[model samples]
Target: MTPRPTKKSPDRGDARIRLLEAARDIIRAKGFAATSVDDLCKAAEVTKGAFFHHFKSKEDLGVAAAEFWAETTSSLFVNAPYHQPADPLDRVLAYIAFRKAIIQGDLAEFTCLAGTMIQEVHASSDPIREACGRAILGHADTLVADIEAARQAHDIEGDWTAESLARHTQTVLQGAFILAKAGNDPEIARESLDHLDRYVRQLFKLTEENKC
Candidate 1:
């Protein structure tokens, strides 16, 4: 049986959104190759004809799914509470803590949609892989501002640019998901995120008192 990835469903007649939602959830639980158009149609409760009307092929759906995931998730980060902190450094740490706090339930529930898809199909599906890459890097760009601000305010001189550090968060996160899946526990992923938090703290040269 295909994993039931989500309970949310779009309103009737919104076939495209249903399919896209189904694609995002199911593809995370099941690899892209293992997740078929029929699986998506069944999860979406949409007929095959309806699926075809919106997407010409499963690969097309995959591309659209990656884009949809980017749009939806990027919006979430934009308004997240972590950005509320006044200090840029505090915001950066809060961002990492926010990432840590969300690790719960089944691996599929918390793991990234784009990371899961590209990990499996990057070799064979150029369009889907590129779409996933954009989704990942696009989100990484959001952190650059805070990281750059923190670096400038602290006069933190280093070879690393804020852009590279921002992308590293994704690298560590995607790796964390893989490790979590392999270890069969969500806590395993949190362990990696903990290391990330400490690493960021060290870079900022925060003492024990300043950390608070």
Candidate 2:
């Protein structure tokens, strides 16, 4: 199905933002390679001229889309309720729980834009792949402090650093989305997160009953 844009039309000057929003939704559904410039223009309710005015090429738009994804999701995770917990471990677990909870509605709604884009363009486009990588890794960076804190608080012994574990969280999530897509079930994504939650719990020497 051709995914509908999140909005119909913006006021006169918001075309760029609308196009990026359209790219986020459409690319998540159809992927970067499959989604054409014409498709984006149609979804954004803008002309082809307007798209080229903002983005020099489709590749430029792909880079911008990845950066946009990073900025928007960064704000969301920063302000999320998961960060409210007093305990670092609680915060970490809460983050996992929050990820699991948000797996609702359409797959395109909850899946990572960067993940989808990177999987498709990683081999073919250097700039787009880097942009997508930065977005994914940068988001993973947000979890590092909390993971490190939990590690120290629990004196957790391991070969892994907070950074590696943080990236691993994304790995699990991206893999989960792939599984969800393959199985055509959102629960598959949630179930992968459940395993992630358990892994973190075990890493911190906490039991299932002790989960936050």
Candidate 3:
């Protein structure tokens, strides 16, 4: 949902793709446990037989949905406006800006699927949980290279590693989504991102007047 631009697609794709797309949106909105196979099938306009043909069980579909989320979202980041800046730190800050920029429409419209699924299924469903872990951590990992680049470029030295801070960005982001979901306000999430921006600036010894 972070990309927000392509909120929903036409129902022109094949059954498997249609189901995966439905799961992506439905699970983000309804939570993994509450969204049943029938709900997904109805949304995707597919039959139960088609659902089972593509996925063995709901758990299997959960895993596939996490994987699908990872695949679809990574492309958004790769070509995002965040990468336009010259300085690595600027790029990092731009990445945050891009994140905030995309937090539009309803809360469910912009929530993170992996973050949502992992929280719901971590204890009860290991396959889904692990799949979510890979999606979340994989996204976190994407930030490492840019973060490390910014660290080296700025000559930043700290007890913290780029890897940890990169992971932390996701931590704050996911937490923001959780708050927004509970509060029924998207601003709650954007406000957390505001703090995230300030925290990252603080980490890099940036005063407000001089921050990227």
TM-score of each: 0.94, 0.95, 0.93
Checking candidate 2 for backbone clashes, the offending pairs are none
lDDT (10s digit) by residue, model 2, range 1-212: 12345555568588898889889998998989899999999888899999999999999999999998898777778788999989999999999998998898898989989999999889999999999999999989999999999998888988999999999999999999999999989999999999999899888988758656
Candidate 1 ranges beyond 4 A from true positions = 1-12
Model 3: per-residue Cα lDDT over 67-103, one tens digit each: 9889988888898889888888998899888888889
* lDDT (C-alpha, whole model) for all candidates: 0.88, 0.90, 0.88
Off by over 4 Å in 3: 2-13
Query: Which one is best on lDDT?
Result: 2
lDDT of 1 at 48: 97
lDDT of 2 at 186: 94
Candidate 3, after superposition: displacement of residue 77 in Å?
Answer: 0.7
Candidate 3 C-alpha error for residue 107, in Å = 1.1
Q: Which digits, one per residue and each the tens of the lDDT, describe model 1 over residues 83-144?
A: 99888999999999889888887887788889999988899999999999999999999999
Query: Candidate 2: where is the Cα deviation over 4 Å?
Result: 1-8
Q: Each candidate: RMSD to true structure?
A: 2.8, 2.5, 2.4
